[model samples]
Target: MSEIRKIIEDLRKNKAGMRGILAIIIIFAYGILGSYFIMGLNINNSIYYTVITVATVGYGDIIPVTPLQKLFSTSLALTGLGLLAYIFTIIINSFEENLHDIRSGRHMEKRLAEMENHYILCGFGRVGTAVYEELMKRNQKVIIIEKNDEKLEDIEEDDNVIALHANATEDKTLKKLNIDKSLGVIVTTGSDVDNLFIVLTTRELYEDAWIISRASKKESIKRLKNAGANKVISPEVSGGNDIYFAAVQPNLVHITQNHGIDFLEREFEILKKHNCHLENIEYHFPGIRTPVTRTIGVLDEEEKDHFIDMVKNNPEVKESLDVMYNSVNGVHSHWISGPDKTHVDMAIEELKKEGNLLGINLDFKEINEFTKQFKE
Candidate 1:
């Protein structure tokens, strides 16, 4: 309803166009009046005759019997035909104008210029589509740049998504999207070369721009990073790793795939809190949790200092501290008693802020609960 109102408003924007439409309406009314009063026909028959004559149907059922009637009818038919031709011309011109707007991107230019702090997503292929949906779900501000006209048609007309039919590799297109004011950019084109170029162009345009790009080949990863991408992900490699893990560590796969990272974080924190008493110099973090065996990835110089002080005071606390440092490092944290789910989540988020630490993630709720014992 709102869109219809908007379209009507736009149609009326041209005063000449509205006047022409009004003229057509008045002419139709005149024809009906002349057919009824002047031609001495009944009102119903008068409307019917006028409509048919203007349409040029000429059924020949009703004849203008008198000489004056015939002359009046002939004039009405000719005038109606001329007006009909004019109306057709107006419709054609309006259609051409709209088509030109779509082709030239004039419709999007102003809207794009007004957007800021939005995300720019390049390409609309499979990967790009997934990213777009996820961003939409998160309620992020996103604008899509897709070159393929066929793919753009897939987007529903009523959807709130902003899609541009333009190549993203061009600097002019990026500028039009207000990339300089955007928070981040995602490049999901299948071609590594294209993704790299987009990253480079985006980086050049916005120095502080956060860019994440997809690369198909291993070598393309480093090149994309060098081109100024914050993160370069290879879907093939990640998919292969998932497959390998699913086969070798089926239980682990089920835990991660179904329960989510929160479940793991909560569970890990629980185990660590219970086992805090058994922290020895030869202590292991994941060994007691399950049958699986893997070396811990975290390295903490800060925790090492705190652990030495603990060993002299209470050797058990030092041992427990060692397991935490071995699991997650490079964070200022402190231990808290009787942790709940909320605290466990907050601690996990806090740990994540330290960024990637050796990529060896564990499922221990107690780990996070007791993980962050920091000096005030």
Candidate 2:
């Protein structure tokens, strides 16, 4: 049973290659030859007949005359059928494997395209998993680069998450994950220097990507950030903060209640050519109960016209139109903050009215719960 389990694990980790299929073809050919020679069957063109029969291209030129030949023919027929079945099964399995590879390739491509606004989390250990959970709560799209085979199994169960099992600092691995397009990257390896190396490589590849690293030692923080990490967090400092909080503000010592909002920070880039009018607007509204503030950026002539039409048609918006104009950048930027539910409804109403919004992207995550637990 243990050996069988090990075999199963190995099979899951390693896909059957072309060599396996070729081996099946060889076996089938040998079976065809055995059928021909074992029964001493004679034919006008034995080799040619065997080829055609094994190839599944039967011709009437070669015929079995004797009873022995007929019996051998029957055996050959059965063997041919079995070989064909085996060949087809192998071919189908290969095709399915190729299809899966293609699907995974496409998924990685899509993840790369959004790299400019996404995060790459390296390692999938306990700490790394916690970071991933927090990122998920905030509805952040992230690519997890882990090396452990066991962790890959856990991540594979999540259809929404993409996992690449490779060295996070390797250029080839980074390129596969489209590290250049990422908005930021988090290096949380157990080794402080490994995290520093990842940050250095990521910053060099994508200067704009925010590289946040975990430093295991107190002295490594400065070196990590200096190595191009935008921020270096020392676990010791974090532990110190927790200890201080425990000693002083025991009730508020929970990282989840205060720092929980950190996980709630969502960033979205508008999808081009979307029909929703208020799509480009970035609102910081927390929940449905909070009031929202609106800030409008510069608008083009067409957008300005649409805005005017929306304000004129909606009495509520007309009464609350603080400012409406184009900006120096020539693209309109709108800021809306309010009770989450009400503001979202109002924004949607405006979107419906103007038909100008392209898309409303969301990064709705719930990190407070996990962080609160961590604090405890």
Candidate 3:
């Protein structure tokens, strides 16, 4: 009984892995040969007799003749028929177990560990399907996490798709999907609260990962962003804009539809058609900051020239307070600009001894909200 239980467990875990199949093959071969020699039967007759006996349909026409022949037939019938029945029953049960595992998404766990830099798309509703289709067209590796089995059904038609039929908002599910190494994440579930929670969970797991989430309601957009989404898209807002653009500016809509041209390429092509020339395009993130309008002001007109003369040559003072800056010249890149911030304190301190720092700002990250929005 213990051995049978172990065999069943093995078959459940790894279908057709037990010694049953091999043992059946060996038994069949043994029975065929034993019948041919011991019963003094020809190859064809031996095969027919062995099969019929194993199937418990022994015909009188292929009867064993003597004691040796009858003994071989008895042994062959008992062993082959018993083993075949046992293996057949177990195989059927194993197949059903395998199907259950597949339906419940248990089989996906092994493959997730091998994936890195894949996309985690958490949802399989109408919006999620659209995102998935776009990703598929781009030939991206994506792992879909959808709770509804019916919603996940379409993706299974795609053989390469690896989907986890589970709740996306759960941390355990995200861990199973290997969210830490994912290149990016998309949350387009119907529920705004669920999407927001998934985004927060994902951010906690992998802080710097780029996450694009859908806001089912307009109010949820800001809430999702505050919860740590890199980009919170209100589908209603976006779809309305697209519909408006398609109606009002069809050509612009047509041009933007080509996602490969979502960058500056579309503009270059448009300009080129009318004999316009495009210089090289450079993307400066955290933008090239303009210097402050006022950094050094003086209430004392008397000491203005004296202070200027002292600090003119020593403008780049080393004693200014530690702040982030772009270190193109050995300066640490953490420099935050807006020299207006520190010059007052520096000037007050500078009154004691050396020249003051006529401020120059430091590094600003590329694609900062200011730089992204306010393009000159």
Candidate 4:
């Protein structure tokens, strides 16, 4: 019963097109009935007289004097004339609406079909915008599904993106965008619950697509991950990490900032050469002499600079750096080096002063400790 009601509602929504089709049918019927009545009456006038009489534009040239003719004329005038008016009106409105829908539908279908390996971003808020900018910088293809009209208006002018102003959790909308063919999906809406819903919907619809979601609360992280989000991030958690790193590892932060050796930049270079992690064996440091564990995070400025320089000078090194940078997460350990120890240290101190780390740090000792712990 509910399904029947839904079908009825859908039909109502497309009533305009149906009305147009009905109008055409009625017009044809009137023409056929008029032709038959004229032939039966044995009218001597031209076919123009038949058309005029049936159309209610009687010129008095062909009069229906016989009772049968009068009766038929009266019936046709009442029924056919009324139907003609109603059909004309309905058809005009219907065609206009149908034309609009058809054009828009075809355009959407064509665009979706042409898309391949694109990123399906499930919001247009601040975080979503940042993600889009980053993806655009890398020349990645992206499609945005945002419910907010104002937010969508902001991105409509961008040629690189295909924006769908609709609910992200709707299977219809996601399917229209060809989510199954997408490389990944990012849910960065303001609501953690909304993000989770989007993640769940995408996972269910396209089980192989990678999903990254944003969560507001700590508890939502596990749920989002379980819902098939490859990664779940909390803005609050990131902010807290930055604060803690500034307070605890001010020196390291300063070094990283001064040398301009950041994670994103390093990762970008590494992926250019080597596409995967398993292919690389050795990672060179800037000024450090000792060999570092694979799982250890590097905190010193000089060491980070050294690593950056090595990757910059060699193509293979750059490729490796890119791969590692792309793969590393908040949970993994990695090395960071700039040019000189003093410069690195100074930069780290500056970052600490500026509160960039969000209270997170990877000191030499901490790196060693984490590496040992993970190894064991």
TM-score per candidate:
0.43, 0.49, 0.41, 0.46
Report per-prediction Cα RMSD to one decimal: 15.1, 16.5, 19.0, 14.2
lDDT of 3 by residue, 1-376 (tens): 7656755687656645556767767877987898778887889987888788877788788887798888888988898777878878876776677668677564466678777656778888777776776555334467888899887765653334687778998888888877776667788889998998998988888887778888889988899989988777777867322211121111110000111112223332333233222211222233455322222211133443354444334445322211112111111111111112133233223322322112222134432333443333
Model 3 segments more than 4 A misplaced: 1-107, 156-160, 239-376
Off by over 4 Å in 2: 1-46, 134-141, 149-167, 176-183, 191-194, 217-226, 236-376
lDDT of each: 0.60, 0.52, 0.57, 0.57
> Which candidate leads the pack in lDDT?
1
Q: In terms of TM-score, which candidate is strongest?
A: 2
Please give the distance, in angstroms, between residue 285's alpha carbon in candidate 1 and its true position after superposition. Answer: 6.2
If both were scored by TM-score, which would come out higher, candidate 2 or candidate 4? 2
Q: TM-score of predicted model 2?
A: 0.49
Cα distance off (Å), candidate 1, residue 321: 24
The true-versus-predicted C-alpha distance at residue 219 of model 3, in Å, is: 1.0
